[model samples]
Target: MVSLPEELQAREAAARQRVEELQAEAAELAVRLERARAALSRLEITRETVMEVLADLSAAEVEAHDAPDPRETPAPHGIGVMAVPPWREGLVAGVLPDVYRDIVEIVADAPGPLQAKQIVPRIGLEATTAKIEGTRGKLKRLVERGWLDEDTPGRFTLARHEGDAGHVNSR
Candidate 1:
């Protein structure tokens, strides 16, 4: 029979080897995670660009044919904000996709800063963790673009318009 001490040493070596393998796997995963995050950031920027182009086209169309709705609240720079619900179309409607604009409108109209969970029901999206995370990502982008403000981590409110220093709750 093999010696007990020799068997224990072999097992210890095997365990150490497993630990080293796991550490290597963890390092690989960390690199992959960074790559994924970078790709996502690029995608967000592309989406923002596409949205801006669409908004410009829409604004041109409006200026060419449609008379301004006196009932609609006009933005300071003439960027139209479309209605989210009770609010009139102004800036959010002009620049963002329906979902992103809705998110901004929800936060803009909220009595206080709102978390993703709190926003899901009002926005009528199904409450999934992925959906909530997507909402969080959009909110972060809006903050980066100066459309919304992160009141705290994972909580959002309307951003103050740079030109609207006196305008109350301009989104």
Candidate 2:
């Protein structure tokens, strides 16, 4: 027959081994959890970028083309394929009066005044009343301030980023 003390010792050893195995698994799981969190953070940033782009496009709806709807309704495609206006990305970022500083950052970061609807979620709108004209008014003011020169009636582009003091030195 097996001795009682030896049997108990073996059982205790088995339990200890099981604990070590569980500890190793826990450490690995911790690593995986950290990796997943990092991936999620990156995805949030991407989502925000996409939202920003979409918001810009929505805000610039005034420049919509006269093209007839290809479909009765637009189908939902995957990411990065949304219909955004290429022309009015500048207006999306902000107009000159309100967004001159912001525009400088966007211009410096981007290749040009791109269809930057990518920044919509990043630049979320706050609650405002009908009297409160935020970015839109700033853009109009910028045209008046000569911070932006009008490419067309609604479309305005920055005259110069710096040293202009919101006035056009020359036409």
Write down the TM-score of every candidate.
0.44, 0.39
Give model 1's TM-score versus the native structure.
Answer: 0.44
**Best-fitting candidate, scored by lDDT:** 1
Candidate of highest TM-score: 1
* Candidate 1: regions farther than 4 A off: 1-92, 162-171
Runs with alpha carbons beyond 4 Å of true place in candidate 2: 61-78, 83-171
Error of 1 at 156 (Å): 0.4
Measured with C-alpha atoms, the lDDT of residue 13 in candidate 1 is 100
**Which pairs in model 1 have colliding backbones?**
80-90, 81-89, 81-90, 81-91, 82-89, 82-90, 83-89
Candidate 1 per-residue C-alpha lDDT over 38-152 given as tens digits, one digit per residue, 9 for 90 to 100: 9999999988987897688656755665555533543333333432222223433443556776787777678899998888878898989988988888777777766777868
CA shift of 152, model 1, Å: 1.2
Global lDDT of model 1 = 0.69
Every candidate's lDDT: 0.69, 0.50
By how many angstroms RMSD does model 1 differ from the true structure?
A: 11.0
> What does candidate 2's lDDT look like per residue over 1-171, in tens digits?
899999999999999999999999999999999999999999999999989987786666555677434223332345565422222222222222223445434433543442223322224554344223454454455456444455665444655544443222111
